[model samples]
Every structure is written in structure tokens, then in C-alpha cells.
Target: MTMVTPGSSPSPDPDLVQTILLSLRRKQGTWVAWAQGCQTLQQAKLTPQQIFEETGFEPIQQNQIVVAEQVYQSILKAGLSDKAQAHFDQRGSDLLYELRVLSQADRARVAEFTLKHGLEADEVRELVKPVKEYSYRKENPPGFGDGPGDAIAFHFWKLARQKDDLQDRSRLIAQGLRFADSDGARQQIETLLTDFTVVKEQPAPTLPLYRLETETDLPRIIPVVGQMPLTIDDLKAVPVAVPENPFGMVTFSGTGAWIAVPGWQVIFQSEDPVGLLTRARQLPNYPAEAADEPVLVIVDRANREWQDDGYFLVAQAEQLTMHWSPSPIDAPILGKVVLILRPKRILDEDYNRQPWQLDE
Candidate 1:
């Protein structure tokens, strides 16, 4: 792959790239929403240009710009040099994304937090605390409704697939849904849930097995993509970098591998769950595969996070019994872990996707 240096211009427009990406994402989301019956078209059949023109774009909050103005005013009041204000316009939005949530009332706490953790999202989150009224309340006040109704609607709609009985695809694609105010408004949601089938409930594994690997030819962590595992043989391992302090979140690629971290492992994945089990059976020192029913082998020993009787509600399964637990083997030198995947929503046959297989 060819490397492009910083500030180098590409042949294509950057704004166009962002627009195309945005449109594709919107199309995907809309298709999913239509399948689940969350959206209804506002108008009848229209041309492509009309659809684009009529599509609802959210009002620009200009939050970063507003915060930038406030900061500039504060800087002027402090009698800071003009040079400080010059860089503010370009860098102000960047600072707003990191530090805008800081409460003006808690200036002391904000200073302390910024001094310790720098101006980052984690610092902003750390500095902010729950409202006192909600913190230790025994019961919600009268007329206090549940938060995140829209989120609930979105999640439900995302996971569901349209029923075969439903026709008029174009209408669904264009119409805006009348949210549940009365029974008439709620009919679509009710119908969708009743007709749609969730697919993640069916996994290839019939049984969960706790197997003990007792061999010398140990399995190695293989890199499918470029991502390498964060390996650790020590339980008390500290992050190599000083910036990963307090409540910092480090986002990393989870390439399929038998990764050994201080507390967790990134197990291997396959195109199909059956293929994954098949490969695990072939590995030396790994336990033999189960007969008749396919088994998912989990090796557990010397790990503090292991829980035998626990279950987690995963996105695919959407049930409490579909939770995650550690593997059966925990040998740092001779153990490999198979990746466990959460269930994904089943989409319409017309809207199905295939994983891209690049040359190995």
C-alpha cells in the first residue's frame, strides 16, 4: 500500500467523500428502519433529486462554534495576547469535542481534573457527576417517565426484519412514521414485532463445553489482518504509556487471534462458527470435539474473571442466557482461545450482505 503524507491533497474532493459516506450510511440505516417499520414516507413517489431535496437534515446546533466564541470572550477578559486568539478558531472545535461538557459552576473540580488528565473526553466524563436528585432516590417522582424512548425504538427497529406479508416497499422507504400517541399510531410497531423474526437465537454450537487442554505443541496467535495482540503473561501488568491513566478508553482493532492480555484474550474467528469449531478440534493439545452435537470449548483456570453460572444479554441473542464467560484453559504458554461472536440481526433476503474475502 502506498503511504500519503500529512497535508497531501487527493485527486477527489474531501467534502464529496464525506457526503458519499454520509449518504451510504443514511441509506443503510433507512433500509434497516424500513424493514423494521420505524419509518413511513412523508410524500408519494418522487424523483431522486426531489428525495434528496426533501430529506430531513438536522438543524445545525453550532455547539462548537458557540463554545469557541465563549472561550474567545473569556480569553479577551483575561487580557491574553492576540496570538492566543489567532489559533482559537481552527483548534477551538477540537477543544470543544474534548472539553465542552465541563460545568462552569465546578471550576475548581474542572481545573483539578484537567491538571490530572488533560483536556480529553475521559476527563470531561470524570469531571461530570450524576444529579443529586437521581443519585440515591428510592422511587421516581410522579409523571417521571423512562428516559431513552427513541433509543428503545431505534434498537428494536434495528434488530427486526420485515415480514413477508408486508408489501408496498417504496411507500415504506419514503413515508415518515407517526410515532405512538394513540393505538392507530402504534399499530406499525405492534405489527412489525408480531411478524418479524430475530435470527441470532440460533448459533451453530449446541452445547458449551469446558475442556482441559493437556498437550505440549501449543497454539499460536495468528494475525489475519495487520492487528497484533496485546500479549501479557503478568496479572499485574500496567499500560506501557502514561496517558492511559484513571478512566481512559483505548480503542483498538480486534483481529482474530489467541490474544493473552493481563485480564482478557481476543480469541480467533472464522467465516462460519462451524469452521471455527472444526479448526479448534485440529489444534494440538486442544481437547477432542464433541460427537453428534457441536460444542464450544472454553478453557478456564487461573483467571479471576471466570464465571461458570453467569450469562450476558448479547445483541444477537437479546436474551440473558446468551452472556459471555471465559475459556476453560488459561495456560499462558500452551493455550489458544477461539473467538466467541455475539449474534447479529437477520435482514431481508434482498438486503443481505456478504463478508469481503481478500486474498490471504
Candidate 2:
């Protein structure tokens, strides 16, 4: 590995820079290894000033060196001009400061994008900056859930993932970033909701179903299909037990209590959250499905005893995005209607069901 020192002229060549930066990790193993060295020298009675002066290395936070080297590598891969390269070396610490928020996996991905796209070092830093909530109703496209969003509108713009008019919808949403918030640009926000893939409901759940029985002392338990627009609170409260196995859950059935249903993963996302609960309350109280034969019930708007029209359920199937949970309360709030897999039939002739995971 090449020696890199302060005030030394750094190479502009992308390949050379990447090689030297990559070697930092291999030789030192990880920033933690360097930290261990610091502790060891101190244990040997070396003073902090003496250690830095003699050993020629200062103690660094875990991943600090890793992040520094990573920044150098990204700068090289970005193929920025010489001035930009110098800017990166000078601002290396700032880039690291910005990257502090990313997980190891996500930080690596940002580096990968830097390498792939040849973004300028500064641009690369800005690209991974986490997007906070920027609400633009009607004209806005989407908000990344839970985790931070990438600042690159191009990144999310590419999420259209299919060829359709929805591509325009995505582009329009991205537009909100540049134009929507500006004066007089509010009219440019696209009000038309893009139609994602229309979900198809299978008559039976794809997985095998074991009867989930409620305990005698507990409240009556019933299992509802995800096609029913149940909220996150409702799904978590579904009498499914804390799973002993990845595919196991405690549930209730008419004939027994504390029933164990294997091969079911409880997961969720909210698509049409506003009306989800309202629809659920109006649902016909059918035995969720026949015992031993789980069936799919797409919970859109259902009619109960009423003479009303245009009544929207607070929580309904149309608002769901994705849900695949085994236990309960663990489903991710998807914030909008997407698609959910309702496993109506999760078992077979021999009474065994291998859990099937549906990637939403």
C-alpha cells in the first residue's frame, strides 16, 4: 500500500487511489484493531502524547479510519477533477461526519454507487444524505419509510420499476423536490394517484393453516386475512402467540385454546391507512376461514347492516401495502396501499405446511 500523509500530493488516478484505500482495511483489519493497538500501548505505560509521537498513529473511533479510507476510495471512483479530489481530501472529515448516519450496509451501498456512477466526491457525499419527511400531498411522489431517504432524486425516480404511465407519476413526484416547494409551483404537484400493480387475490392462502385457538380465559380470537384492511394495532393483537419457531404463532380456534399455527409470517404495510379501520368494523363476522382450510378474503369495502353509500372505512384493504408477519405488532407501516399476501391454504394432505415468504 502507498503511504498517504498530510501535505503529500495525492494521486488523481481512480484505480491507484482505490487500491491504496482498500489496503487500509486489509492491513489494519478494522478501525477496532487500531483502537486495540491504542489500548495495548497505553497498558504498556506509554503516555498518550508519547504514543502519538512515537507510534505515528493517533487513537481513532471505531470505523473512523474505515470511513476515511472509504471516502478516499469513493473520491477516486467518482473520477472528479483534480480540484474536486483536493476538495475531498480537505473535506474528508466532513464527508465522514455526514456518513455517520448510515448503517454499515447502507454506507457500503453509497460507496458502491459512488464507484458505479463516478459522481464527484462532494456529490457522492450529498447523494447519501438522509432525506427527512418532505410532505407534498397530491403533487408529491412518496416518502421513504422509517429509515432516511437518499438526496438523489434520480435514485427514487428510478423506482418506477416498470413501464407504464406511472413512470410519469414518479417523474412528477421527483419534480416536487425542485419545483413544488418553490413559489407558485404548488399547482405542479401531480394529484393523480399512480396505479401500482393491481393485486390479485387467490381463493386460498398459499401457505398451510393450522387452527389458531384462543385461550379459555382470554378474549375470543379470530384470524383475519390481510386483504381485510386491518390496522397495525389490530394485526398485532391477533391472538397469534409469540412464535417459538420462525414459522410458529399462538392463535385461537373455535374448538381449542393457545393454538399453534406454523408456516405463517405476520407482516404488514399501510397503503390506504386513513380508511383501513373503518372498513374493518363493517366486515361481516364470518369465521375468518374454515379450520384446516384458510381462504383469502380481500378486505376492501364490505357491506354490513346499513343503507349508506360512499362510506369509507378508516382502515380498509385498499390502503394496505404489504403485510407478512408471523407473530403480531411486528408488521411495518407501509403508509399506502400496495399489495399483501393472504395465505388461505397453508397446509396439505399430510397436514404439513412449509412457510412461504412472499416478497412484496
Query: Over 4 Å off in model 1, which ranges?
Result: 1-61, 78-87, 97-118, 128-360
User: How do all models score by TM-score?
Assistant: 0.17, 0.23
Which digits, one per residue and each the tens of the lDDT, describe model 2 over residues 1-360?
112222333424555333433443344444434444444444444455554555455534323444465545544654555654554454444344344334443444454444344555476455553231111111233432222233344233333323256656567456434322222222223232344643232221232112333222123334664676778887776565343221132436444433222222231232122222112212222244533222222223322212111111222112232222111222223332222222322335244334566899
| TM-score, predicted candidate 2 vs. hidden true structure | 0.23
Output the number of the TM-score-best candidate. 2
lDDT minimum window of 10 residues, candidate 2: 130-139
Residues 99-145 of candidate 1 have per-residue lDDT tens digits of 33322322222333233334554534432322111212234323222
- For model 1 the TM-score comes to 0.17
**Residue 265 CA displacement from its true place in model 2, Å:** 48
Query: Model 2 scores what on Cα lDDT?
Result: 0.36
Highest-scoring model, lDDT:
2
